[model samples]
Target: MKKIAVIYWTGTGNTEAMAHSVADGARTAGAEVAIQCVGDIAADTAAGFDALALGCPAMGAEVLEETEFEPFFAELEPQLGGKTVGLFGSYGWGDGQWMRDWKERTIAAGANLCGEPVMANEAPGVTELDECRALGEALTK
Candidate 1:
Protein backbone atom coordinates (compact mmCIF):
# COMPACT_ATOMS: atom_id res chain seq x y z
CA MET A 1 0.00 0.00 0.00
CA LYS A 2 1.05 3.55 -0.58
CA LYS A 3 2.15 5.36 2.56
CA ILE A 4 1.22 8.94 3.27
CA ALA A 5 2.12 11.29 6.09
CA VAL A 6 -0.22 14.04 7.18
CA ILE A 7 1.77 16.47 9.28
CA TYR A 8 0.52 19.76 10.61
CA TRP A 9 0.91 22.57 13.13
CA THR A 10 -2.14 24.46 14.25
CA GLY A 11 -2.67 27.38 16.58
CA THR A 12 -6.48 27.39 16.56
CA GLY A 13 -7.13 23.75 15.60
CA ASN A 14 -8.45 24.75 12.19
CA THR A 15 -5.52 23.23 10.38
CA GLU A 16 -5.55 20.25 12.68
CA ALA A 17 -9.13 19.47 11.70
CA MET A 18 -8.15 19.73 8.04
CA ALA A 19 -5.23 17.39 8.64
CA HIS A 20 -7.58 14.73 10.01
CA SER A 21 -9.86 14.98 7.03
CA VAL A 22 -6.90 14.64 4.72
CA ALA A 23 -5.76 11.52 6.50
CA ASP A 24 -9.26 10.11 6.48
CA GLY A 25 -9.56 10.58 2.75
CA ALA A 26 -6.16 9.03 2.10
CA ARG A 27 -7.08 6.04 4.21
CA THR A 28 -10.39 5.71 2.43
CA ALA A 29 -8.55 5.77 -0.85
CA GLY A 30 -6.53 2.73 0.31
CA ALA A 31 -3.38 4.44 1.38
CA GLU A 32 -1.69 3.80 4.68
CA VAL A 33 -1.92 7.15 6.44
CA ALA A 34 -0.04 8.39 9.47
CA ILE A 35 -1.12 11.70 10.91
CA GLN A 36 0.99 13.61 13.40
CA CYS A 37 1.73 17.08 14.69
CA VAL A 38 4.78 18.72 13.12
CA GLY A 39 6.61 18.57 16.45
CA ASP A 40 6.10 14.84 16.69
CA ILE A 41 7.76 14.01 13.38
CA ALA A 42 11.24 14.82 12.24
CA ALA A 43 11.66 16.37 8.82
CA ASP A 44 13.80 13.50 7.57
CA THR A 45 11.23 10.98 8.72
CA ALA A 46 8.37 12.91 7.17
CA ALA A 47 10.34 13.09 3.94
CA GLY A 48 10.45 9.30 3.82
CA PHE A 49 6.73 9.01 3.22
CA ASP A 50 5.52 8.06 -0.26
CA ALA A 51 3.35 11.15 -0.25
CA LEU A 52 2.90 14.12 2.08
CA ALA A 53 0.03 16.33 3.15
CA LEU A 54 1.37 19.32 5.05
CA GLY A 55 -0.76 21.81 6.99
CA CYS A 56 -0.06 24.96 8.94
CA PRO A 57 -2.30 27.92 9.60
CA ALA A 58 -1.29 31.34 8.36
CA MET A 59 0.40 33.40 11.02
CA GLY A 60 1.39 37.06 11.26
CA ALA A 61 1.73 38.81 7.92
CA GLU A 62 0.17 35.78 6.24
CA VAL A 63 3.11 33.48 6.60
CA LEU A 64 3.56 29.98 7.90
CA GLU A 65 3.84 29.37 11.65
CA GLU A 66 7.35 30.59 12.19
CA THR A 67 8.66 28.59 15.11
CA GLU A 68 7.89 24.96 14.32
CA PHE A 69 6.39 24.50 10.89
CA GLU A 70 8.75 26.78 9.04
CA PRO A 71 11.91 25.15 10.36
CA PHE A 72 10.53 21.67 9.76
CA PHE A 73 9.49 22.61 6.25
CA ALA A 74 12.87 24.12 5.51
CA GLU A 75 14.59 20.95 6.57
CA LEU A 76 12.23 18.84 4.52
CA GLU A 77 12.31 21.01 1.42
CA PRO A 78 15.66 19.77 0.21
CA GLN A 79 14.44 16.21 0.36
CA LEU A 80 11.23 16.89 -1.53
CA GLY A 81 12.75 16.59 -4.98
CA GLY A 82 10.46 14.39 -7.07
CA LYS A 83 8.20 13.72 -4.08
CA THR A 84 4.42 13.92 -4.19
CA VAL A 85 3.13 16.72 -1.98
CA GLY A 86 -0.17 18.27 -0.97
CA LEU A 87 -0.55 21.59 0.85
CA PHE A 88 -3.36 22.84 3.07
CA GLY A 89 -3.83 25.62 5.61
CA SER A 90 -6.16 28.20 7.15
CA TYR A 91 -5.86 31.94 7.02
CA GLY A 92 -7.79 34.64 8.87
CA TRP A 93 -6.54 37.61 6.88
CA GLY A 94 -5.03 38.50 3.54
CA ASP A 95 -5.36 36.57 0.32
CA GLY A 96 -3.94 33.03 0.44
CA GLN A 97 -0.53 34.31 -0.48
CA TRP A 98 1.02 31.87 1.92
CA MET A 99 -0.41 28.85 0.17
CA ARG A 100 0.54 30.28 -3.20
CA ASP A 101 4.08 30.93 -2.10
CA TRP A 102 4.18 27.50 -0.55
CA LYS A 103 3.04 25.85 -3.77
CA GLU A 104 5.68 27.69 -5.72
CA ARG A 105 8.33 26.64 -3.25
CA THR A 106 7.20 23.05 -3.44
CA ILE A 107 7.36 23.14 -7.21
CA ALA A 108 10.76 24.76 -7.16
CA ALA A 109 11.90 21.93 -4.91
CA GLY A 110 10.81 19.54 -7.72
CA ALA A 111 7.95 18.06 -5.76
CA ASN A 112 4.96 16.89 -7.78
CA LEU A 113 1.88 18.59 -6.36
CA CYS A 114 -1.22 16.40 -6.31
CA GLY A 115 -3.61 19.22 -7.15
CA GLU A 116 -4.36 22.82 -6.33
CA PRO A 117 -3.44 23.70 -2.79
CA VAL A 118 -6.34 23.91 -0.36
CA MET A 119 -6.93 26.86 1.92
CA ALA A 120 -9.64 28.00 4.28
CA ASN A 121 -10.28 31.31 5.91
CA GLU A 122 -10.48 30.85 9.65
CA ALA A 123 -12.17 27.56 10.42
CA PRO A 124 -12.76 25.40 7.37
CA GLY A 125 -16.32 25.02 6.26
CA VAL A 126 -17.78 21.77 4.86
CA THR A 127 -16.73 22.64 1.31
CA GLU A 128 -13.17 23.31 2.31
CA LEU A 129 -13.04 20.13 4.34
CA ASP A 130 -14.31 18.16 1.38
CA GLU A 131 -11.69 19.79 -0.79
CA CYS A 132 -9.09 18.76 1.73
CA ARG A 133 -10.34 15.19 1.47
CA ALA A 134 -10.06 15.37 -2.29
CA LEU A 135 -6.55 16.68 -1.92
CA GLY A 136 -5.76 13.61 0.18
CA GLU A 137 -7.23 11.27 -2.38
CA ALA A 138 -5.25 12.95 -5.11
CA LEU A 139 -2.07 12.35 -3.16
CA THR A 140 -2.90 8.65 -3.00
CA LYS A 141 -3.05 8.57 -6.78
Candidate 2:
Protein backbone atom coordinates (compact mmCIF):
# COMPACT_ATOMS: atom_id res chain seq x y z
CA MET A 1 0.00 0.00 0.00
CA LYS A 2 1.13 3.53 -0.60
CA LYS A 3 2.16 5.20 2.63
CA ILE A 4 1.34 8.91 2.95
CA ALA A 5 2.21 11.55 5.50
CA VAL A 6 -0.06 14.50 6.32
CA ILE A 7 1.73 17.24 8.25
CA TYR A 8 -0.23 20.28 9.35
CA TRP A 9 -0.40 23.11 11.86
CA THR A 10 -3.74 24.68 12.67
CA GLY A 11 -4.50 27.63 14.90
CA THR A 12 -8.28 27.67 14.48
CA GLY A 13 -8.89 24.03 13.60
CA ASN A 14 -9.72 24.71 9.99
CA THR A 15 -6.57 23.13 8.59
CA GLU A 16 -6.69 20.32 11.08
CA ALA A 17 -10.19 19.45 9.93
CA MET A 18 -8.98 19.45 6.37
CA ALA A 19 -6.13 17.13 7.26
CA HIS A 20 -8.51 14.49 8.60
CA SER A 21 -10.55 14.61 5.42
CA VAL A 22 -7.42 14.27 3.34
CA ALA A 23 -6.38 11.24 5.32
CA ASP A 24 -9.82 9.75 4.86
CA GLY A 25 -9.57 10.05 1.11
CA ALA A 26 -6.04 8.65 1.05
CA ARG A 27 -7.19 5.65 3.06
CA THR A 28 -10.21 5.17 0.83
CA ALA A 29 -7.79 4.82 -2.04
CA GLY A 30 -5.86 2.17 -0.09
CA ALA A 31 -2.95 4.22 1.10
CA GLU A 32 -1.51 3.88 4.57
CA VAL A 33 -1.41 7.30 6.25
CA ALA A 34 0.00 9.19 9.19
CA ILE A 35 -1.45 12.60 10.12
CA GLN A 36 0.64 14.80 12.38
CA CYS A 37 0.96 18.35 13.59
CA VAL A 38 4.13 20.20 12.63
CA GLY A 39 5.56 20.16 16.12
CA ASP A 40 4.96 16.45 16.40
CA ILE A 41 6.72 15.57 13.21
CA ALA A 42 10.15 14.00 13.32
CA ALA A 43 12.66 14.78 10.61
CA ASP A 44 13.12 11.99 8.06
CA THR A 45 9.69 10.48 8.78
CA ALA A 46 8.73 11.12 5.16
CA ALA A 47 11.38 8.61 4.10
CA GLY A 48 8.82 5.83 4.40
CA PHE A 49 5.86 7.63 2.92
CA ASP A 50 5.03 7.50 -0.76
CA ALA A 51 3.26 10.84 -0.78
CA LEU A 52 3.10 13.95 1.39
CA ALA A 53 0.16 16.21 2.33
CA LEU A 54 1.19 19.53 3.90
CA GLY A 55 -1.27 21.98 5.47
CA CYS A 56 -1.00 25.43 7.04
CA PRO A 57 -3.03 28.62 7.10
CA ALA A 58 -1.83 31.72 5.31
CA MET A 59 -0.37 34.19 7.74
CA GLY A 60 0.07 37.98 7.53
CA ALA A 61 0.86 39.19 4.01
CA GLU A 62 0.20 35.70 2.74
CA VAL A 63 3.19 34.15 4.41
CA LEU A 64 3.55 30.75 6.03
CA GLU A 65 3.33 30.48 9.79
CA GLU A 66 6.93 31.10 10.66
CA THR A 67 6.95 29.96 14.26
CA GLU A 68 6.45 26.32 13.41
CA PHE A 69 5.19 25.30 10.01
CA GLU A 70 7.59 27.42 7.98
CA PRO A 71 10.65 26.31 9.84
CA PHE A 72 9.56 22.68 9.75
CA PHE A 73 8.88 22.86 6.04
CA ALA A 74 12.11 24.72 5.42
CA GLU A 75 13.90 21.90 7.15
CA LEU A 76 11.90 19.43 5.10
CA GLU A 77 12.70 21.13 1.82
CA PRO A 78 16.13 19.57 1.66
CA GLN A 79 14.81 16.03 1.91
CA LEU A 80 11.93 16.41 -0.54
CA GLY A 81 13.78 15.70 -3.74
CA GLY A 82 11.82 13.32 -5.93
CA LYS A 83 8.91 13.35 -3.52
CA THR A 84 5.22 13.61 -4.41
CA VAL A 85 3.56 16.37 -2.41
CA GLY A 86 0.12 17.93 -2.06
CA LEU A 87 -0.51 21.35 -0.51
CA PHE A 88 -3.63 22.52 1.36
CA GLY A 89 -4.59 25.43 3.54
CA SER A 90 -7.24 27.90 4.74
CA TYR A 91 -7.07 31.61 4.11
CA GLY A 92 -9.03 34.42 5.65
CA TRP A 93 -8.29 36.93 2.93
CA GLY A 94 -6.13 37.98 0.03
CA ASP A 95 -5.88 36.51 -3.49
CA GLY A 96 -4.64 33.07 -2.52
CA GLN A 97 -1.10 34.23 -3.03
CA TRP A 98 0.05 32.11 -0.17
CA MET A 99 -0.90 28.94 -1.98
CA ARG A 100 0.58 30.16 -5.21
CA ASP A 101 3.81 31.20 -3.58
CA TRP A 102 3.90 27.98 -1.62
CA LYS A 103 3.48 26.01 -4.80
CA GLU A 104 6.42 27.81 -6.28
CA ARG A 105 8.53 27.24 -3.20
CA THR A 106 7.72 23.55 -3.11
CA ILE A 107 8.58 23.14 -6.74
CA ALA A 108 11.83 24.99 -6.28
CA ALA A 109 12.59 22.82 -3.27
CA GLY A 110 12.47 19.69 -5.45
CA ALA A 111 9.04 18.36 -4.50
CA ASN A 112 6.64 17.79 -7.36
CA LEU A 113 3.13 18.93 -6.59
CA CYS A 114 0.61 16.19 -7.14
CA GLY A 115 -2.03 18.72 -8.27
CA GLU A 116 -3.24 22.23 -7.66
CA PRO A 117 -3.20 23.52 -4.13
CA VAL A 118 -6.42 22.93 -2.19
CA MET A 119 -7.64 25.99 -0.34
CA ALA A 120 -10.72 27.42 1.38
CA ASN A 121 -11.56 30.95 2.34
CA GLU A 122 -12.25 30.12 5.96
CA ALA A 123 -13.48 26.87 7.40
CA PRO A 124 -14.10 24.30 4.72
CA GLY A 125 -17.62 23.29 3.96
CA VAL A 126 -18.54 19.85 2.65
CA THR A 127 -17.52 20.54 -0.93
CA GLU A 128 -14.06 21.85 -0.08
CA LEU A 129 -13.47 19.03 2.35
CA ASP A 130 -14.45 16.57 -0.35
CA GLU A 131 -11.93 18.15 -2.66
CA CYS A 132 -9.21 17.80 -0.07
CA ARG A 133 -9.92 14.08 0.16
CA ALA A 134 -9.89 13.77 -3.58
CA LEU A 135 -6.50 15.48 -3.64
CA GLY A 136 -5.17 12.92 -1.20
CA GLU A 137 -6.37 10.02 -3.34
CA ALA A 138 -4.93 11.58 -6.42
CA LEU A 139 -1.58 12.20 -4.80
CA THR A 140 -1.25 8.54 -3.90
CA LYS A 141 -2.32 7.31 -7.30
Candidate 3:
Protein backbone atom coordinates (compact mmCIF):
# COMPACT_ATOMS: atom_id res chain seq x y z
CA MET A 1 0.00 0.00 0.00
CA LYS A 2 1.05 3.56 -0.56
CA LYS A 3 2.51 5.21 2.52
CA ILE A 4 1.63 8.86 3.10
CA ALA A 5 2.79 11.27 5.75
CA VAL A 6 0.57 13.98 7.18
CA ILE A 7 3.00 16.36 8.85
CA TYR A 8 2.20 19.66 10.55
CA TRP A 9 2.98 22.33 13.09
CA THR A 10 0.19 24.30 14.74
CA GLY A 11 0.03 27.12 17.25
CA THR A 12 -3.73 27.15 17.87
CA GLY A 13 -4.49 23.56 16.88
CA ASN A 14 -6.25 24.70 13.72
CA THR A 15 -3.65 23.16 11.47
CA GLU A 16 -3.44 20.08 13.66
CA ALA A 17 -7.14 19.45 13.16
CA MET A 18 -6.65 19.80 9.42
CA ALA A 19 -3.80 17.32 9.53
CA HIS A 20 -6.02 14.71 11.17
CA SER A 21 -8.66 15.13 8.53
CA VAL A 22 -6.04 14.80 5.85
CA ALA A 23 -4.79 11.58 7.35
CA ASP A 24 -8.30 10.26 7.75
CA GLY A 25 -9.03 10.89 4.13
CA ALA A 26 -5.84 9.21 3.06
CA ARG A 27 -6.59 6.16 5.19
CA THR A 28 -10.12 6.03 3.79
CA ALA A 29 -8.69 6.15 0.31
CA GLY A 30 -6.73 2.98 1.09
CA ALA A 31 -3.33 4.42 1.83
CA GLU A 32 -1.22 3.84 4.89
CA VAL A 33 -1.05 7.17 6.67
CA ALA A 34 1.28 8.44 9.36
CA ILE A 35 0.13 11.66 11.02
CA GLN A 36 2.84 13.49 12.95
CA CYS A 37 3.86 16.82 14.36
CA VAL A 38 6.75 18.57 12.66
CA GLY A 39 8.92 18.43 15.75
CA ASP A 40 8.29 14.75 16.21
CA ILE A 41 9.43 13.65 12.78
CA ALA A 42 12.65 14.07 10.86
CA ALA A 43 12.56 15.79 7.50
CA ASP A 44 14.36 12.94 5.77
CA THR A 45 11.92 10.39 7.21
CA ALA A 46 8.94 12.42 6.07
CA ALA A 47 10.50 12.86 2.67
CA GLY A 48 10.61 9.10 2.34
CA PHE A 49 6.85 8.86 2.22
CA ASP A 50 5.15 8.14 -1.07
CA ALA A 51 3.19 11.37 -0.67
CA LEU A 52 3.11 14.25 1.79
CA ALA A 53 0.50 16.53 3.32
CA LEU A 54 2.18 19.45 5.09
CA GLY A 55 0.49 21.95 7.38
CA CYS A 56 1.59 25.00 9.32
CA PRO A 57 -0.38 28.02 10.40
CA ALA A 58 0.55 31.47 9.17
CA MET A 59 2.62 33.48 11.59
CA GLY A 60 4.51 36.78 11.76
CA ALA A 61 3.61 38.89 8.74
CA GLU A 62 1.82 36.02 7.00
CA VAL A 63 4.70 33.61 6.83
CA LEU A 64 5.20 30.02 7.99
CA GLU A 65 5.84 29.40 11.67
CA GLU A 66 9.44 30.52 11.85
CA THR A 67 11.10 28.44 14.54
CA GLU A 68 10.11 24.90 13.81
CA PHE A 69 8.14 24.58 10.62
CA GLU A 70 10.28 26.84 8.49
CA PRO A 71 13.53 25.14 9.29
CA PHE A 72 11.96 21.73 8.94
CA PHE A 73 10.42 22.71 5.60
CA ALA A 74 13.70 24.10 4.37
CA GLU A 75 15.40 20.81 5.13
CA LEU A 76 12.61 18.85 3.48
CA GLU A 77 12.29 21.05 0.39
CA PRO A 78 15.32 19.73 -1.41
CA GLN A 79 13.93 16.21 -1.31
CA LEU A 80 10.57 17.21 -2.74
CA GLY A 81 11.45 17.20 -6.41
CA GLY A 82 9.03 14.92 -8.27
CA LYS A 83 7.21 14.16 -5.03
CA THR A 84 3.46 14.44 -4.60
CA VAL A 85 2.72 17.08 -1.99
CA GLY A 86 -0.36 18.70 -0.51
CA LEU A 87 -0.28 21.94 1.46
CA PHE A 88 -2.74 23.24 4.08
CA GLY A 89 -2.69 25.84 6.81
CA SER A 90 -4.65 28.38 8.85
CA TYR A 91 -4.21 32.15 8.85
CA GLY A 92 -5.71 34.62 11.26
CA TRP A 93 -4.80 37.57 9.05
CA GLY A 94 -3.70 38.49 5.57
CA ASP A 95 -5.16 37.23 2.26
CA GLY A 96 -3.92 33.66 2.43
CA GLN A 97 -0.72 34.87 0.85
CA TRP A 98 1.27 32.37 2.83
CA MET A 99 -0.45 29.47 1.19
CA ARG A 100 -0.03 31.02 -2.23
CA ASP A 101 3.64 31.62 -1.66
CA TRP A 102 4.01 28.15 -0.29
CA LYS A 103 2.39 26.72 -3.38
CA GLU A 104 4.80 28.58 -5.58
CA ARG A 105 7.74 27.39 -3.53
CA THR A 106 6.56 23.81 -3.70
CA ILE A 107 6.20 24.07 -7.44
CA ALA A 108 9.61 25.64 -7.78
CA ALA A 109 11.00 22.71 -5.84
CA GLY A 110 9.59 20.46 -8.54
CA ALA A 111 7.00 18.82 -6.31
CA ASN A 112 3.80 17.70 -7.96
CA LEU A 113 0.99 19.33 -6.03
CA CYS A 114 -2.08 17.21 -5.61
CA GLY A 115 -4.52 20.12 -5.88
CA GLU A 116 -5.01 23.64 -4.62
CA PRO A 117 -3.64 24.30 -1.16
CA VAL A 118 -6.22 24.44 1.64
CA MET A 119 -6.38 27.40 4.01
CA ALA A 120 -8.64 28.57 6.81
CA ASN A 121 -8.93 32.02 8.31
CA GLU A 122 -8.74 31.11 11.99
CA ALA A 123 -10.07 27.70 12.82
CA PRO A 124 -11.03 25.54 9.93
CA GLY A 125 -14.73 25.08 9.63
CA VAL A 126 -16.40 22.13 7.95
CA THR A 127 -15.78 23.26 4.40
CA GLU A 128 -12.09 23.87 4.83
CA LEU A 129 -11.62 20.58 6.64
CA ASP A 130 -13.47 18.78 3.89
CA GLU A 131 -11.23 20.44 1.37
CA CYS A 132 -8.26 19.25 3.38
CA ARG A 133 -9.61 15.74 3.22
CA ALA A 134 -9.99 16.01 -0.52
CA LEU A 135 -6.43 17.22 -0.74
CA GLY A 136 -5.36 14.13 1.15
CA GLU A 137 -7.32 11.83 -1.13
CA ALA A 138 -5.76 13.54 -4.10
CA LEU A 139 -2.31 12.81 -2.75
CA THR A 140 -3.14 9.14 -2.58
CA LYS A 141 -3.83 9.23 -6.29
lDDT (10s digit) by residue, model 3, range 9-82? 99879999999999989998999999999999999999999999999988988789999999999999999999
Off by over 4 Å in 1: none
- Candidate 2 global CA lDDT score: 0.90
Colliding residue pairs in candidate 1: none
Give the TM-score ranking, best first. Answer: 1, 3, 2
Every model's TM-score: 0.98, 0.96, 0.98
Alpha-carbon local distance difference test for all models: 0.94, 0.90, 0.93
Residue lDDT tens for model 1, 24-103: 89999999999999999999999999999999888878788999999999999999999999999999868988888888
Assess the local accuracy of residue 50 in candidate 2 as a C-alpha lDDT between 0 and 100.
84
Off by over 4 Å in 2: none
Model 2, span 30-102: residue lDDT tens: 9999999989986577545788999999997899998998888888888888899999999996889998999
Per-candidate clashes come to 0, 0, 0
